[model samples]
Target chain A: MNISLILQMAADADPERIGLVCDGERWSYRAIQRAAHGAAANIADIGCSHIALLDESSEAAPIALFGAALAGIPYVPLNYRLADTDLAALLQRIAPAYIVGDVERAKRLAPEGGHTFCSRKDFVAAAEAAADTASGEEREGEGIAAQIFTSGTTAAPKAALLRHSNLLGYILGTVEFCSATEDDAQLVCVPPYHIAGISALLSSFYALRRIVLLPAFDPDDWLQLASAERVTNAFVVPTMLARIIERIDEGVQADLSALRAIAYGGGRMPPELIDRALDLFPETNFTNAYGLTETSSTIALLGPEEHRSAHNSSDPAVRARLGSVGRPLPTVELEIRDEEGKSLPAGECGEVYVRGEQVSGEYRGKSALDAEGWFPTRDAGWLDSEGYLFLAGRADDVIVRGGENISPGEIEEVLMSHPAIAEAVAVGVPSTEWGEAVAIAIVIRPGCDRPDDTTLRTLIKDRLRSSRVPERIAVLDEMPYNEMGKLLRRQVRAHFQDN
Target chain B: MKPGTKLKSAVCDTEVMVIRGSDVEVMCGGALMSEDTPAEKSAIDTAFAEGTLIGKRYVDSDGSVELLCVKPGKGSLSIGGASLQLKEAKPLPSSD
Candidate 1:
């Protein structure tokens, strides 16, 4: 089934239900369906192989997404924040396309000039005005629905393909159709390019929840909108949550009692920050979702009960569950494998491998799944006795000092526990004596005195093995994170390379 | 029938998409299902009037022929005079 079936079913079930809210305008389910069909006709007439969106979050996002699916073309949401050269390279890769966003920017970045361009305003208007009849060829379930570029924190981005089957399986397996009440509204602030953003749109649509789009994220603006819209649910990255918490700390309050659930992912959540958030929003249910773009979205989730139990538990093992991303979804199979490619037992840290109907480990021109269909996530992690999965940093981020492999996440967690440290990242730097040595960068908390390197090293040495201690520490005003809140360790490693 | 083919009931508003292919004729409200819209509504068969639910999947006893109800109406899905069972929901928390 094509992804358009989702919107079609929703519209058929209740055409008059409010489906989307953006900038004071409310759109019903039938209206969005009509616009989607219109957009599909426009896309098919243009005869483009793909439809690309280069703008921030807006009404055009869902329109272009479903339109591409209905028109039997892949929807590629390009990162508008990319540099001119980088953005141009991507545009060239998906050339002979119908690009939708800023018409002027699309014209300026047209590589080889084979692509068609339309302004976001014009696209939405044309879609609304076109015929409501289905206007495209039937698309198969195996067809590529979206081509998302992975967030390249350590290396160049790869175009990951998510088939219609993969995305539909994820939605059908996780969400109950039209389960949301009429009053429920979800506030979406994540950019359109991210997997979380895409899945949020699809899942919310299927659940029949009214979607409120925030084109850009600002802490005050987010709080105000949530309060004004009575947003019942929201999804945020760790960085966004931190900023929102900071805004709350400044005594700027809105009647956020309407907010009932908040899910966070896209980055690691600091234990302290989550604890503070839990206390601050006592009535809200918290969920921690963990997945990659290739996995189609979340493969595992730490649900609300798990959050509260782990937070209030006195046992170390139970409390440690707070750091876990919870067990794999019942529909998914997860295993930890060692460097030798053998499956590791519980509590053994190794690379994560996952297999499921939703796991589409396919990139442009290549498939990353093994013969048995397991996709090696390249993420270092371990499952506890209770099946809770705790993620280390990326396998590539592991600091190899001499013959020992040290997870930078371990050392960073220790450093971040310090009262004065706001954020920390550990990386491996070249060392003649030991082949490589641990180096750390830290961002101090506001108004807190910076700790000496010796003091920090002593803290790590006390909590971990001596070899895990950093040989060098650098204090920065802030840690480098990509737009999605993923820490860029490669940039941190660069800081100590020349020293 | 082939997977992904949509069929509407000749007797009611019931609509379904084939999720598993099978050669057996499918029936809704005791009337044969077809791809075309019915010219007019027919009398609902009381014997098979249990009703179909939106978003619910119905499968044969042996689980060969599966149909997902896309539009609900007063018609239960069946194959060869036997009513299809509603597939059990797999309870999973929303993660997106």
Candidate 2:
């Protein structure tokens, strides 16, 4: 089934329910469906094999998303933040594609040719004009629903192909259709290019929840919009959450009592931030969601109850779970495997592998799944006896100092525990003696005095092995993060190299 | 229909995918379910009105036939001659 079926379910169940809210306007489920149908009819006429969006988060994003699904074409959301040359290069890869949003940038990609481009405003206007037009017929046979470009932190981004069935599997396996009440609204700040953004649209629409889109993230704007709309649900990256927490602490009276749930992912969340957030919003539910662009959003979720229990628990094991990403989804099977792909028992760190209907490890024409359907997620992590999953950062991010591998996530977690430090990143730097030595860069919280190097080193030595302690420390005004809020480790390493 | 076949209600907006297929009739609101389509309102039976919900699995007594409710409806589901009961729902935390 196409992903549009999800929206159709909501439209059929309650047409009058608010489906999307953006820029001081709201569209009912029926209205969104009509717009999507209009867009679908328009897209089908173009005969493009792919539909791409080069814009920020907006109503046009969702319209293009469902419309592409209905047209039996893959919906591709490109990073609007990429440099002109790089953006044009990626756009050329998907030739004969219909490009929507940011007509300026879409036109810049015109040199590639074989592309039809339109701004979000024109897309909306055209779709509305074609509202009465029939949207052809339901897509038959198997088809690709979305083609998302993975955020290339270490290497060039690859297009991850997500089939309609894979997206449907995620929707069917996770969300309960039309389950959200009429009063429920989810605040979406993540850009359309992110998998979380796409999944949020699908799951929220399927559950009949109102979506409030933030074009770009600003702490003040996010808080103001959430309060004004009385948003009950939201999803944020770790960096966003840290900023929100910082804003609240700085005399911003945010009446977030309407917020019932807040899910965070896309990067590791420090335990200290979670603790502060819980103390501030005692009644709100917190969830730590872990997934990848290839995995169709979240495959494991640390629930609200687990957060509270871990926060209040006396048991060390239970308390340590505050750092875990929780157990696998009911539909997913997870295992930790060694280098040889042999499964390892609990507490033994290795590469993470997952198998599920939603696990679309296929990138373009290449299939990353093994014969058994298990996709090897190149992440260094382990599961406890109770099935809680812990992350040791990306496998590639491991700091191999003198042939002993060390996970940056472990060292970062320990450094973040320090009261003065608000953000910390650990990286491996060139060392003449050890091949590579641990290096740390931190952003101290406002008004907190920066701890001396010896003081900070003693903190790590007390908690972790002396070998894990940072050989060099740099306190910066802020750490580097991509627009989506993921740490740019390559950039962080560059900082140490220059110093 | 065989297992893994997705079907829509013939009498309501309910949609489901067969998980444990059987050679017996599978009815939604007393009407046989087929592909996704609008079922006649008159076909909705008041006798089997417990209603189906999305993300919930409904199964027969011996677990030979199972269906997951992909779309909710006022109509109930049944397999063979037995009414399909709601399986215990183990809700995973909303991840995204």
Candidate 3:
């Protein structure tokens, strides 16, 4: 069954189950599904494509989404948080039949398409009307379901076209992994448009679980809601989790006893934060999910026990492997390869390649896969002696000193341990002598005097090889990052390159 | 001046006008007694008559219905009644 069918099933199985909760307002599954059908009927009259489009919203958004599925129209939720320009670029790439969200922004940003932008009032009314409709059986698969954008290691953001089947696999796989049942309640803090968000939603939908939605996230509210709603599961970002741990450090109580699972990915979680959360919520299971939009949501997950043991492993080799995103997820294949595309041995560090039911073949705008039918993840990491994966850094982020390769992540991880430094981002700055050298940008902790460039360089030299020593250090208030909290090293380098 | 020239507008009453081919004033302003409109603004009071969700709940752009705790301003919408409220409902950070 496709996504809409899942919603229909949930409505039938437990009509009174609270499917949506926002700001103390709650709506049952039946209420939400009926409203979506009304949205679908109205949308069908305009007739863009049989695809339902949702712009991120706080309330009444999910109903419209479900209504599209009822109409047998594939629904695509666009990420509304991006800058107007980036959003426009993604809108162009999607070129879906219709759209929803900031009507003005959507109109201005997405003008070329033969689509319509329904205003906020009209949409709310549509949902209300649809809510009165009796249960209707939704038809099977039709158009594309969702178009999620992945940041390209190359030029522009690449749009990943996801079919109903794509969503089906992600949702079902996650349910099986987590043993999700009807008893679960998911607090959805991530934006609806991201692949990760969709994955979490689909999994909850399949398990007939209730979803507590948060339009945007604040660390405090997240904790409070977990306690108040007794939310069983949640998805958080590394940055968000780091801040939550910071709160824990400040004597915040772990009121999240009801939370069963906390899944995080997007970027590497600083080891310290994970350790802190494990100690705080000893009963809560932790999952380290790893994937790009290209691979549904996550192609691999390190389970709570395995993850903790890996972190606590005495052997550096064992710990490294455990820290690595655990072995390929069920039905997924992982391989490390050299430049020639020949698969490398288990322990060698090279481009990490994945292939699975969740993996897509091509990028919407460009060819993501090489001539050999494999997409280069552009991430540089080595499979260890134990079949564990340890990511060095992005292959593009690698620092090439003449011919030697250096991982900037290593330097950043080391610098982060310094008492004065709060956050660090290391980039490969262009060089005249060597091809590229490590350049460091540090966000110092409050009350600490700015560490001089010489002092930082000396610090690196004392800890690492001379080659790994950063040539310069610039003090920044905060490292620039995308919404997912992944540092944009390319942007960081560009910001200071002229100087 | 064209509708685009004026960067902002105010709604003086509960209803405003939206030109099919022009900027339409939407439900906005959080829980305030009055809404202002620019000189170029058109009243869309007819939407209240035609709007599907509003007759029962007075949602001002946001799908909020005078809830005690949650408040929102203008909600965003997609084509064909695809809408959602814009809430400042991020979990409030507390001093731990």
Candidate 4:
């Protein structure tokens, strides 16, 4: 059940196969295993319960990952983008740990916790030295494999624990071993802290696909590497895809014939962008992966065929499939439930609940799963008659106007349909008459005159009910978003309220 | 070997996990498999000397037993003195 078992399986099956490409250097499966063995021994020597990585994507990511697994400790990947004070505070909370990445940042932590620090190079060297001396003994399967702090889009961050079994269960159920072609190379642009990054590594390792790493995502660099590495597969967030399409439209030409598939998620994708991307990459398969960190990356996905069919379908219902997250994975069971926890019928908006082998509903000290094994995702969504999951905004994002629950997603979608509106987010603003009213922060298309608030309200009113029309509309030059592409609705609300 | 039992090759670096429990002997390169570090290399049995590939599962003809090759090795997998054939891969659509 150990996550390292996946890497060992790949190395055992094809020792000479290339496993990773970083900094223009190729790493074979055997090479990674050997490095992991060394790194594990070093971690074991440190005698820490956790190994935290505070750096960007590097060869050290996988090494520290598998190495921590072999050592029977949880591998924690911290968001390297955190402010110094915030990062130090988090380090203190996870102290008495073996910290790898930026040595200087590690040294800045509180000294009373007995935390140990080492540069990635030093850790690799130490692991290499201990390779022959360390035992690759198998440990119990109950050990934690990784601890990722939730992105905390709406609230304070919480450390989520992913056990060995949860991760292994995901790979076993979703990915077939060695299914990818030897020529397949996957370009990974997500940071190490994200669940997609971890899943990409493990799945690619099991499939024996050569991984090409992008240290940081710049659309141009992503395109350049995709062409140079002949990347056949890749994953990007919604924002990255938008920027790439923008670059392509700006006439940056690079042959991307080698790319066979592209998966995008981590935030809501604008249908217009997906439409352009589908037209731009006619030969490439596109997938809309939907999952939370607690669900181990992807519990549901809109597959390539569905995307193509939905795009070509003329029926309004079928064409609307472009906005859905498709069906749940075979390994997962989905339930849409009301506040009373009663299962709701199709087309009924409710909280999204899921249960599966891969779902780790436990944070560091709390288990969120109910007695029946259903974990409420706290995300508002609905399942249509065809079982397509349409995500509304977060449950907290619901605006209550005179006791009527209004969905911000619905209003935002309507606003986005306007030809002049580029991006829009609807949030609940304080209202004396209606408890809370719909207020929108919008980004208008460049060089387009701002649409009057009355016009925007009329557009939403015509499409939906009059109650759904936004009460306030504040135009902005750009929308506020976190690095992962999740709309910062809280920030948007604060901005509107302040000005 | 029982299901979930990890067996390391005695002749080479091949490792496998028993997917279907069985009493048959799991051999790699004409040598008995063990859960610990394998014994020194043994002479390859000419009939079953074909190299094993990583991540491919090998199973008996009766389908009573299966082993997922965890690591590739110079030794091919065999069960009950009969060489096991590589199982055909099932390609699941890429999710992420």
Candidate 5:
């Protein structure tokens, strides 16, 4: 079924319910559906194969999203922050498209060729004007609902296609229809290009929750908006959370009591950061969601109750659960496999493989699913005896020294535990003696003196084996990270080469 | 019936969208359901007056002929004279 059905069902159930809030404007469920229908008509008239949005969060996002689905075309949300050349390359790839949002940037990069462009203001106006127009009969058969470009930190970006079935499967399996009350509002700051952002819109609409959009993430703006709108739910990346915690530490206070739930994903959450956040928002529910762009959204979630239990537990096994991503969703099946494609028992780290209706695993020209339908997530992880899944960064990020596979997360976790270290990254550098030797870079906490190399070495030796100790340690102002908060390990490795 | 097909009861305000379809005839309030608008309302059958709920899914014993209630009313859902059981909700924490 098309994702447009999500909006249609919600609007039909309660047309007068407030659906979206953005920049002090509120829209009802029916209004959003009418605008989507209007946008769909325009897309069909232009005969565009794809609908692309090249701007930050706005009402136009949901309109263009459901509009493309109604028009029976794929919706592609591009990262506006990409370099001009890279943006131009992506634009060319999805040409013969109806591009919405920043028309100026489209004109500059796309050169008014092979695509239709409309400004965010004009698109919303035109959509409202054509609200009465019929969007035509529902398109038959499953079609691509979205074509999201993966944030290629390790490689070039690839357009990952999520079919309508896959997205619907995720929404239906996880969200209860019309479960959110009228007072419920979700503060969305994640960019539209990310899978979490896309799923946030879909699931919120399905659950009939009001959405409050922040065009761009600013901790100050985010906090103020949440208080003004009484925002009850939010999803943030680790970096965003860290900054928010920092802002709170600086005495930037707002009535954040309305925040009932906060979900975080898109990167690893440091144990220290979470501890601070838990203490700060004692009443709010915290969830650690883990999923890739290939999956529709979250496949595994360390939920609120688990968060509180893990934080308060005295048992070592239960306490370690704070670092896990929790068990897979009820609809999903997960396994950890070794290099030979054999499933490994719990407590052994290996590549993560998942199979579920929501698992698309399909790119523009390729299907990544194996014959058995399991998608190799390429995320190195292991499941504990109780089935809690713990991630050790990406499989490719594993450091190999003398045929011994060492997970960088193991060393990074130890370094991050130090009181003086604020951020740490462990990587393998070329070594004539060990073939590849462990190297580390650390960021010292503000106002804290950098610990000597000997002190740090003893800390590692106390917790891990001597081999895990870094042969060389570099103290830097900060570690490089992508916009989504994922550490740029390749850039970190390059640091050793430069020195 | 086919998946994604919307059907309304002629006897009541109930409306449902087919999630899984089979050759079986879907009944609401003891009357056959149709895609077109009902010209007249009929009295509910006392035997099938248990009532349908909004946003709930009903399915046959075998799990086929699944329907999601987009609109709730006094009508009960059934198939081949057997009342379709309410599908139990498997709640998962919202993580989006």
Candidate 6:
């Protein structure tokens, strides 16, 4: 069924169970439901066919969220991390019926139309009282829930059209994979507005789990919640995992006994990091979940045991397969295809394609899926003989230095093997000779002096061919990473563009 | 590295009631290096200069936001329409 039904089921099963938590406040299932009802009433009164709201990390997030769903109004969670100009362009693109936020800033920013702005605090206060002007169920609230923009490196942003079904799939699939229970408590470090974070919060509501919202990700607060609240579930990116692991490496200790399952993946994860975590939190169940906004959240997972068994790589094949994305979930049918859209045998690298109830056929204002309805993930890699998927990187991210196609991840993977290298990213920079030249950027371990560019290039050259070695190495005080811990290779590419 | 020090702080939503003459600036998440989506090319334009946030609520790429406080030039910036000033503005207390 849909997300609305899932929430109804959970509310019916346990009305008093804690559904959400923020700061010192906790919203029980009944409380969250009433607040959702309040949101619907407010949406109706405010008169928005489609609304764009900026903040979802607040206590009012869930109410305004489900309220949009109940009101049959499509809502766009504006990406607050974007520069104001880009946001201005995006807001101009959508021209939302009404904008939602606090009053102080709106008057300063959009002084032209002060009346159109709605205070989130006011909506939240009204929702807490459960005022229902509509007063009843509106079953056909089949309107879109969100228009999330994919981070476009090569082109303009494309808004992914996510319906209630798409979001429900993410919630249910995530809940099932984690085996979430009523007693489970969620500590969300990811922003609630992003797909991964929003999905975590929605899944909590469906499972009647307690949720602690963080306005943003902070490792100290993360560890504190895990130790204090016995947080059972988390959604994080590999970089976040890397940072936490680094913290521990620096002699900081955290009691993570409460964590049960964590869903991860914005990009690739270093197997070494996973090995370390398994040792660090043996009690916590870990899953490497793979998905895109096109398919909600997770379409596949490599369970803890799978990680444990496959990690010991004696054979080159097994070692390579250790990097596998694991098997496709029951909800999805995954396939490997060549450039012609023809299916390929196992162990051959090709574009990964997914078809499922969870996968959407098109993006808003654009079509992303093929004629056959398979969402062709531009990621290139092979599915091993045992049906395990290994990702090289995005197909577009593959750098052709001279005639040889080189995956930046391959070079970075080898660079990461150096003990002193804390994080590494390789990107292709334009060259007059090679069409594109390979360049490397690195972040060294704290307190450790970085290797000179010559030594760093020699390090990669020793493991790889001279051609595979980076033409230049730039060591920064820190490797730039996002909230989810993924490396921003595109940003790195821009550095070498003019140089 | 003190464990408790806030690593980064974004100026989310702000009201400009007073502009007392400070260099109005905003620090935003320039997190595109790690993401593969092609649309992230707009980042250069995304970095908000002090002058851009005037009369505009700047939304970022990741959904975390900072309202551009107009630094009227020198003393302390204030909300243009409201009475609040940087001196009068109270920091949102830290939460667990």
Please report, as a residue range, the 10-residue window in candidate 3 chain B with the lowest summed lDDT.
Answer: B87-96
Per-candidate TM-score against the hidden true structure: 0.95, 0.90, 0.75, 0.89, 0.95, 0.76
The Cα RMSD in angstroms, rounded to one decimal, for candidate 1 relative to the true structure is 2.2
Question: In order, what is each prediction's RMSD in angstroms?
Answer: 2.2, 3.1, 17.9, 3.9, 2.1, 20.9
Judge the docking of candidate 6 as incorrect, acceptable, medium or high: incorrect
**Candidate 6 Cα deviation (angstroms), residue B20:** 64
- The alpha-carbon deviation from the true structure for residue A286 of candidate 2, after best TM-score superposition, in angstroms, is 0.9
Q: How would you encode candidate 5's per-residue C-alpha lDDT over A371-442 as one tens digit per residue?
A: 999999999999999999999989988888989999998999999888989999999999998899999999
lDDT by residue (A115-141, candidate 4, tens digit) is 888898888778778878778765553
- Chain A TM-score by candidate, in order: 0.97, 0.94, 0.87, 0.98, 0.97, 0.89
Clashes of each: 0, 0, 24, 9, 0, 41
What is the Å distance of residue A468 in model 4 from its true position?
1.8
After superposing candidate 6 on the true structure, give the runs of residues whose Cα lies further than 4 Å from its correct spot: A111-115, A130-133, A139-142, A172-180, A246-255, A312-322, A444-469, B1-96
What's the interface RMS deviation of candidate 4?
2.4
> Which residue ranges in model 3 land beyond 4 Å of their true spot?
A50-61, A69-74, A92-97, A108-113, A127-143, A151-154, A177-183, A248-254, A311-313, A365-367, A370-373, A417-420, A445-466, B1-96
TM-score of chain A of 4: 0.98
Worst 10 residues of 1 chain B by lDDT: B87-96
Cα DockQ of the candidate 6 complex: 0.01
- Winner on DockQ between 1 and 6 is 1
> What is the per-residue lDDT of model 4 for residues B12-80, given as tens digits with 9 covering 90 to 100?
878887767567788888888888884466677766678887667788898788787777788888876
What is candidate 1's lDDT per residue for A1-499, written digit by digit as tens? 7889999999998899999998889999998888888998888778888899999988899999998898889999988999887888888888899998977777787747599988889999988877455564555533999999986765678999999889988887788889999999999999999998899999999999999998899999999999999999999999999999999899988889889999999989888889999898888899999999999999999999999998889999999988899989987999999898999999999999999989999999999999999999999999999999999989988888998999988898888789998888889999999999998899999999999878997898889989998888888888888888888887888878765
